[model samples]
Target: MFRNGLEPWHLLVVLAVIILLFGSKKLPEMARGLGKSMRILKAETKAMREDDAPAADGTANSTAAEQDRPAVAPVTPATVTKADEATKTNTTA
Candidate 1:
């Protein structure tokens, strides 16, 4: 495979083109824009990682004691049935 890199000659050509196209005065402005773009990208990437990390490592996040307990009490139909019966009885009567 072709080496994936800009040789010194390539870099020199690029720098010459940039300097010719944009005078030295404008080069500072171009560099400022590039730096701002990089900062924005870095912040967004970090935020994405933080969001994904919580979901990815959620299982490991629970406290040791919490992990030992059942997730929730079994939802027995009888408990709900009694409440519904009461509500219906009151509504009808």
Candidate 2:
């Protein structure tokens, strides 16, 4: 049964302790870093939520767009062998 948890004075004391431990000069820098990290995290979560949401009658168009894209050529062992040979020649010469 915790009543009146974390009053204004409690926050002020915590802030004072933090300021004492990190110093006034470093506090702004730490706050800026925290703000930047929070912004990045917010942006990523927003993007993830958008991706999770279903497209509105656009699935067919997306499938068509995907089909229109050119397929990637597969890498072969011969191509890798050639690349290795070229690197070996350059290193030795």
Candidate 3:
């Protein structure tokens, strides 16, 4: 018989359970981290939206964004010679 789906006491019980599970001392740290994460997410979403918006001078934002980002070297598979493989095998053995 779940007539009153959620009352004030129900919320209090849930809060009590959370406090019991993650102690009172850790709650503030968790809350602070959550707040920081939310702020970062908001900022990233704003930046993405700005990047999507067209410039007034008809220039693409991609060029500017690309310039701001660091270039990473492309990863290529390493070619192992028989000598190298043999050295690895020797070391392991």
lDDT (10s digit) by residue, model 3, range 1-93: 789999999999999999999999999999999999999999999998988898889986675768899989999999767988899999999
Best-to-worst lDDT order: 3, 2, 1
Better of 2 and 3 by lDDT: 3
lDDT of 2 by residue, 1-93 (tens): 569897999999999999999999999998999999999999999987876666896563344457799999987675345788889999999
Better of 1 and 3 by TM-score: 3
Give the alpha carbon lDDT tens digit for every residue of 21-47 in model 1.
Answer: 999999999899999999999999997
- Order candidates by TM-score, high to low: 3, 2, 1
Clashes of each: 0, 0, 0
Of the pair 1 and 2, which is ahead by TM-score?
A: 2
| lDDT score of residue 10 within candidate 2 | 92
lDDT of 3 at 54: 89
- How close to the true structure is residue 41 of candidate 1, measured as C-alpha lDDT? 100
Winner by TM-score: 3
lDDT of each: 0.81, 0.85, 0.92
